[model samples]
Target: DEMAQIREFIEIAGEYGLAYEYINCALERHPYKISGKAAIKLLEVGLLMGFKSGRENDKRFDRR
Candidate 1:
């Protein structure tokens, strides 16, 4: 079931021309830590693929 959902999410991201690497990375690193709402927001903003670590990535997502 979880795998199905992940596939579905990848398809949805593909529809938006979003890459799957970040999602796959997040899944690999923190499979059960992601929240549905956060995922949706990330997708909505086209930031799902921009997910990264460290200070630079953090600054990129920070709101002014």
Candidate 2:
């Protein structure tokens, strides 16, 4: 069920979207400067977890 929803979302939104906007404003308010890898791990955006591999055992959805 969850996988189906994710596929539908990707089909609709594609692989790109408003990834930046007022990002500087957000950074200005925040003290920590996160790396690209670290940012993907953040669950608020869920970019990492949101993408799942066919194998449920693999948490990062890495392709083998």
Candidate 3:
């Protein structure tokens, strides 16, 4: 039932401006296998890194 429940979790995450990411782990196999939780963590890490980098560049912008 995990597949059925994933959508529910994804929607909940979206409400908080977050995303549920999915990655293909079995590309060599006939049918690709998806890594669900791992994808989520990867996305979260990427987003955090992007935000941190952006903050470091904040000095380049001038409101006035």
Candidate 4:
């Protein structure tokens, strides 16, 4: 499910995937030139998505 969500997200928002891959490469090679805000925003959105999904899963588990 997580993979599916990630795949859907990548398909729906290709820009974010591009940004992530670019940043991943850039950080490994040269870590100083990346825009901090853009990286932070990306991480924030990712964390939010994970949190929301975890909460939903928790609810489902609790309902059992």
Index of the highest-lDDT prediction: 1
User: Candidate 1: lDDT over CA atoms?
Assistant: 0.54
Q: CA lDDT of each candidate?
A: 0.54, 0.45, 0.42, 0.53
- Model 1 misplaced stretches (Cα beyond 4 Å): 1-24, 47-64
**Residue 35 in candidate 3 has what lDDT?**
82
Cand. 2 TM to true fold = 0.23
lDDT of 3 by residue, 1-64 (tens): 4344455556655422222222221233346454888667765775664422223344454232
Which numbered prediction scores highest in TM-score against the true structure? 4
RMSD of 2: 12.6
Lowest lDDT block of 10, candidate 1? 15-24
Model 2, 32-60: lDDT tens per residue? 68898866654335343353323356556
Which residue segments of model 4 deviate by more than 4 Å?
Answer: 1-9, 12-26, 29-32, 51-64
The TM-score of predicted model 1 comes to: 0.27
State in Å the error of residue 63, model 1.
26
Candidate number with the higher lDDT (2 or 4)? 4
Q: What TM-score does candidate 3 reach?
A: 0.27
For model 4, which pairs clash?
Answer: none
lDDT preference between candidates 3 and 4, better one: 4
Clashes of 1: 0
Clashing residue pairs, candidate 2? Answer: none
TM-score of 4: 0.32
TM-score of each model, in listed order:
0.27, 0.23, 0.27, 0.32
